[model samples]
Target: MAQIDWETLAGRVENAPSLLRLWDALEDYAQACRDVGCTEAECGLDLRRLPTYGGEWTGEYLFPIRDDGITIRSHDETHMLLDRERAEPRYVVVPRSAYNL
Candidate 1:
């Protein structure tokens, strides 16, 4: 597979019509990175450039791990995206580990 431009993916997520689509695309990307054996550094997303809102959305929503060693807290943008009260979805570039894929 060709190297996916992070900027392009970020743009797509930003323009996505809904949160569902954003998550779908992000999940797919995470899978692709895993398939290609991407390193953690290579698979990380720049969270600062993504959108965020107010709320508490845990990382467990995306990656559920029972181990006590693992702590899942939603990234700022993810927190906003997970907000049930928000009509519009937010976007964020989370690391591969964040997805736990």
Candidate 2:
């Protein structure tokens, strides 16, 4: 399958009428996660299929994870634009380390 266009996907989120408010909320959540050594964070709105319909919104924040001089590469799945069922108005911030997993 073709990879989802994250830049374009982000654009969708950036275009929301309440972008600033939403962004601030996400940033606060992400900062809290980062303070606790979190690696990634994301928020997703009502999603059920590809080419999201109305009332759909999504956002993501990724932080570099370093371990032993190695930086783990990761993508934010919450901002993905694929056909899938995602509950509306969901906010999740993964505040943990993968290196210990």
Candidate 3:
């Protein structure tokens, strides 16, 4: 019934032991958050159950939909914790408009 703690969730994913598993966790958690946000359910828990078993993990953040042929520069020098499923420079996009010129 309680809302998810996404910040805490992301931190866990960012520090996951395996980037592949991290990608999975981030993807799942983010998607769950998106679904709950769209539905606006009064009882958040009623939505898809948390993907992780222990309370340390928040299974609700999905991978970001990035633009194709675009380069992302982290002004803050942030690093990417990518996996085999990492987004590519020329990856797929949806809604058409999601792709920028």
Which candidate achieves the best lDDT against the true structure?
A: 1
After superposing all C-alphas onto the true structure, candidate 3 shows an RMSD in angstroms of: 13.2
Of 1 and 2, the candidate ahead on lDDT is 1
On TM-score, the leading prediction is 1
Query: What is candidate 1's CA lDDT for residue 21?
Result: 65
lDDT of each: 0.45, 0.32, 0.36
Assess candidate 1 and give its lDDT. 0.45
* Residue range 2-87, candidate 1, lDDT tens digits: 77676666566555554556565655655555677873237665432434333455443433234332322234443323322122
**lDDT-best of 2 and 3:** 3
lDDT of 2 by residue, 1-101 (tens): 45434444444444434433334443444344445564323333222111222332234212223332222111132322211113222332231233331
After TM-score superposition, the amount by which residue 69's alpha carbon in candidate 2 deviates from its true location, in angstroms, is: 20
Clashing pairs in 3: 26-61, 27-62, 29-59, 29-60, 29-61, 30-60, 30-61, 30-62
lDDT (Cα, 0-100) at 40 in candidate 2: 29
Off by over 4 Å in 1: 1-7, 39-41, 47-49, 53-101
Per-residue accuracy of model 3 over 1-101 as CA lDDT, tens digit each: 77777666655555555434554555655565666764213423222222222222123323332443232211111223322224442222222223221
- The full ranking of all candidates by TM-score, starting with the best, is 1, 3, 2
Q: Of 1 and 2, which scores higher on TM-score?
A: 1
C-alpha root-mean-square deviation, candidate 1: 10.5
